[model samples]
Target: MKEKLIQRYSASERINHWIVAVCFVLLAVSGLAFFYPAFFWLTGIFGTPQLARILHPFIGVVMFLGFFIQFFRYWHHNILNREDVKWMKSVKEVLKGNEVGDIGRYNGGQKGMFWVMTLCLLALIGSGIIAWRPYFAIHFPIPVIRIALLVHSASAVALIASIIVHVYAALWVKGTIRAMVEGVVTHAWAKKHHPKWYREMTSKK
Candidate 1:
């Protein structure tokens, strides 16, 4: 028999997600290159240091907009509840291939990550505008611009770390990547990891 599958992400959602993801990678590489002398070579990703400097902020805007759409669409699902609290408390058990609480559309870790990413993006975009030279930077005092750069750097670091964990979790979970790539998940995978969400999806049919 063919493996049963359930849709997790729609085609539009997958496209939107990839847009943010690709832009994030470009911005992270360019930002790191600008921030650290050791990683300056990373600027080559955008062709030249000057090019990277020019493109990073533009790409950041694009990424922020893309994620903004994602935020509104999924924020409801990520809202922390009693069950999420229970899941967080039993994170050890979750890592041990067991889930705690009635897992919904997202697990506790994923929900936490979503909020972190949301805040980080907000900070990044605000600070980026203040520090963006020849554009918004000219409107700010030098000290204010300096402060914005600091905030932007801090937020970028936090976002990068969050993405690392996000990527690791996606890879570690047996069928998680398929939910994004193929826009579906195996029935068994859903039943094991998110039985509540699985039931909700199936009940409509």
Candidate 2:
């Protein structure tokens, strides 16, 4: 039997998502190496430690730009609504292999993570500029630079944690990863996980 499929993301959207994902992994590995002595070996990801230091900020800029484009593309769908509130309140049930409310393109957890990523990216770029030596850092005072470095580190940790959760959630939910990777999902998958989105898409067809 031929399984029905629905387009969840276009080729361009999937490409952009992957670009950001790759940049994020590179940044996380290098950033951790730079931030902690124990994980300094991770610098090998970008060649030598010196190379990692040089490439970290540049990769960060790319990730920021990539996610910035994604933000504008999907932010509207991620906006919280009454259904999202219901989903959030029943998160425990959601964890027990059940979905809640009339989910659209994203559930409450996905919506929350979207905003968290946005805020973390904003903090990272802003503080990173202030702490980027021999460039914008030179204009800032020593104490201010120290604070920026602190903020940058904290935000990086938060972003890393959030991404970990994001990855886990994607893996935990059946067919979730396929949506991003293949840019399509089975009709059953869509209808089960995002009923409202399924309806919207089907209505258009």
Candidate 3:
């Protein structure tokens, strides 16, 4: 018999995720090129250095808007609760390949990552607008623009680090990537990793 599967993400949700992810990669490369002379060669990824400089802020805007939509769609599922506390406390065991707590649609770490990404995107957008030149930057004082640049850079670094963890966790946890890619998971995967969610899904049938 074929394995039973449960839907985890809709097609649009998966498309939105990949859009944000691609924009992030492009922005990271261009931003790094502009930030460090040693990595100036990275700008070639966008055709030319001048073009990269021009496209970086625009890509940042796209990424921010994409994530903004995602924030609203999944925020409710990511809310922290007693179960999250239990999950966090037993994170070590979870890392050892044991499921912990009555895991819901998301675990403690996933919830925390969601919020962290939200804050970083917020910071990135706000700072990015302030530092955008030939436009908003001229309206702000030099010192203010400098501070905004600092915040933008810091937020970018934090976001990059958090995304690395997110990617790693997706790869480390069996069947996790399928949720975003194919938009479904085997029943066994759902039951083993997210028993509470599994019950909720099954009960609805």
Candidate 4:
């Protein structure tokens, strides 16, 4: 039998997602190496410590730009609503292999993660510029630079933690990874997890 599929993402969207994902992993590893004495060995990811230091900020800019594209593209569908609130309250059922609420293209949890990613990215990029090398930091005073460093570190930690959860959830939910990789989801998968969205899609066809 032919497998029924529904489009979940486009080629361009998947490409942009991967660009951000790759840059994020690179940045996370290098950033950790720079932040911790023990993890300094991770500098091998970008060649040497000096190389990692130089490339980390540049990679960060790339990741930020890539995610900015994703942000505008899907932010509308990600808006939270009453259904999202109901989904949140019934999250236990969701974790137990059941889905609740009139879920749309994104679930409540996904929507929350979207906003978290946005805020973290905004903070990281803004503070990163203030603490950046001889180019931008020199424009700011020592105290200001110190604060920016702290803000940058805090936001980095938040983003890293959130991404860890994001990856884990994707793995835990079968077909979730396929949506991002193949830009499609099986009709059954969509119907089961996002019945309202499934109905909308089917109704349009």
TM-score for every candidate vs. truth?
Answer: 0.98, 0.98, 0.98, 0.98
Please list all clashing residue pairs in model 3, or write none if there are none: none
- Which residue window of length 10 is worst by lDDT in model 1? 98-107
Instruction: List where candidate 3 sits over 4 angstroms from the true fold.
Output: none
**Model-by-model lDDT, in order?**
0.95, 0.95, 0.95, 0.94
| lDDT by residue (tens digit), candidate 3, 92-169 | 999998988998999999999999999999999999999999888999999999999999999999999999999999
Which pairs of residues collide in candidate 4? none
**Model 1, 161: alpha-carbon shift in Å?**
0.4
Going through the candidates in the order shown, the clash numbers are 0, 0, 0, 0
lDDT of 4 by residue, 18-49 (tens): 99999999999999998999999999998889
- What is the C-alpha lDDT profile of model 2 across 41-69, one tens digit per residue? 99999889999889899999999999999
lDDT of candidate 2 at residue 80, scale 0 to 100: 98
Native-to-model Cα distance after best TM-score fit, residue 89 in candidate 3, in Å? 1.4
RMSD of 1: 0.7
TM-score: model 1 vs. ground truth:
0.98
